[model samples]
Target: MDVLIVGAGPTGLTLGIDLARRGVDALVVERAEALFPGSRGKGIQPRTQEVFEDLGVLDAIRAAGGPYPVRAIWKDGERIGEQPMFEPVEADESAPYTEPLMVPQWRTQEVLYARLVELGGRVAFGHELTGLEQDAEGVSARFADGSAVRARYAVAADGGRSAVRRALGVAMTGETVDPSPFLVADLRMTGLDREYWHTFPRPDGTGLALCPLAGTDDFQLAGKFPEGTEFDLSLDGVRRLVAAYTHLDAEDVTELRWASDFRPRAALADRFRVGRVFLAGDAAHVHSPAGGQGLNTSVQDAYNLGWKLGAVLKDGAPEPLLDTYEEERRPNAAAMLGLSTGVHRGEVQRGKATVQLGLGYPESALSEDRRAAPAGVRAGDRAPDGRVDGVRLFDAFRGPHWTLLGAPAAAAGVHALPAAPKSYGPGVFLVRPDGYVGWAGDSAEGLGAYLARAGVR
Candidate 1:
């Protein structure tokens, strides 16, 4: 196989879809018997929505979720004024998705998994990775069920307590973002309006919040408890907690679907890659669920690595292109880690920074800028979506091939589309498969050489 992705969460399944669409041979393996049943990471950022658009699942995702509702602050069982959960930003052509969408993490994974399968990708469930060994050529992964598979490269999307990362002897260095433990659960309950996210504070300084999960008859319950507090994960416990915190009876919570508890943390792997095996998702960096950056960052990690893997395995690109994955993603993940921690500590608000539209690889070695007079859009910036001449920029860039925008009509060996919008200025821009500008120049003088150096002919 070309790539073996361990863990069938959003990261692995997304990578699977990208690889399948690129016609790369890849397989996703999950240790659990099925998809995760919890709604751990619920917020899908705007940038991730763009990724869904490129992956051909945007309509399904949009149909499966809704915008986050205004948060209704509660005190002593009284309804207070409603405040927006996230800062509002009007959708523009450059950034079509200006707000975060609320969907259960399980639904997101299901959507991604279905897309992967539809693209002719295979997923091996109940296959747990026990050990992994890599040579100069390929990787050999041994599963706990006495099964083994060999692949050109492997990714560890197995999550924060990653067994693959542990086997590779990679260390994760981070501090605890919050010492207070928190509980999250998906429950079926009444006595609450779905129009608002309800919050109930405790006298001890910890609090409980419940948000009606979009496209489902369920509310996700989240609560922070004092240190050393022993929380229950049973239906009775859930009902009791709800009754104690809010103006509802214990019977208000009718059902308990899933429950989990954890202390908030922010950690990044010592390295994203170890030889032929790479770490993505929680395996690469574990973030607090405060700013809703953890899962989105993980999906972007898969997006960043998928194209490079496809380029190397299917496009005859040099192997060194794989090195840029860690080079470009680690620092970004580190910055996101800080952002998540800041949100958890109340130092940052959920605003444009959390939207992640501005995230790019300006300092990446793969980015080439040869413009004598640079303008608004430069190399390493995200190629915004717009209409150019008679073609849509995103429509032109939907496929696996690279796109050359605003270049002369005579430029050879590149998909030279119509000139971009005024936002990008008048220059030749070579958009990478991952939708970032790889090379930008006033003309095609140094464009061909840059593409050749980056293994794009």
Candidate 2:
């Protein structure tokens, strides 16, 4: 195989979809018997929605999710006031998804797994990686069930406590963002209105939030425990927690589908690449689920690494192309860790930073803007969505191919299409397969040479 992806969560599944669409031989393996059942990482940011759109899962995702509702505060069983869950932003032609979508993480995984299968990708359930070894030629993984697979590259997306990451001897340096232990449960409940995310706050810096999970009758209940408190993970435990924090009785929480407890912490791997083995998703960087950056950033990690792997394995690109994955993603992950931590500490609100629309690789080696004075969009920026002639910019940039806007040079392998969009200003924009402008110049004077350096032509 070309790539062996550990952990069949959103990160691995997304990478599977990206690689399968590129006709690369990749396999995703999950330690669990099925997809995650919890509504963890439920908020899908706008930028990740764009990625889902490109991967052909946006329709299903949109159908399965809804926008975040207002947060309804409660005190002494009386409704206080409502506040916007996320700072609202108007949608524009350049960015269609201005707000984050609230879908259960399980549903997002289902959609991604389905799309991956549709694109001829395969995932092995109950395949736990017990050992991993990598050499110059390829990587070999051994599973707990006495099974093994070898591939040219391996990725660890198994999560924060990733065994693959541990096997690689990588250190994750981090600190606990909050000392309080948190409990999150997905349960069907009564007596609570589904229109808002109900929150009950205590003066001790602990609180409970019951958010109605979109497309399902269940609500995700998140509760913070006092220091040194030992919480249970049962149906009755969820009932007790809700009743203790709110006016609702223990019986109000009718059912508990799934529940988990954790301490919010932010951690990043010391290194993203370990020879032929690479780390992605929570394995690479674990974020406090505050700004909704954990899952979104993890999915984009796969998105950033997918094209590079495909290029080296299938497009005859140099091995050094793979190096850019760490170079680009590690720093971005670090920034997101800070953002997530800031949101956790209430130092930042869920607004433009949470939406993650402005993330780009302006300093990447593959990014270059030769213009003396760039007009609108510059290299290493996200290729905006707009109409150039009759073709939508996003539509033109979709698929596993590079796109050229405003420049009709047929000399390179990139598809030169219609005029540049107004959002992109006036310049020849060479968009990468992953929807970032790789090169922007006045014309196609050095287009071929730039493409050659990236091994795209």
Span of ten consecutive residues with least summed lDDT in model 1: 407-416
Cα-based lDDT at residue 128, candidate 2: 85
Question: In model 1, where do residues sit more than 4 Å from their true spots?
Answer: 408-413
- Residues forming the 10-long window of minimal summed lDDT in candidate 2: 405-414
Screening candidate 2 with a backbone cut-off below 3 angstroms (N, C-alpha, C), the clashing residue pairs are none
**What lDDT would candidate 2 get against the real structure?**
0.91
Off by over 4 Å in 2: 409-413
TM-score of 1: 0.98
Candidate 2 residue-wise lDDT at 433 = 88
Residue 193's C-alpha lDDT in candidate 1? 87
lDDT of 2 by residue, 28-55 (tens): 9999999998899999999999999999
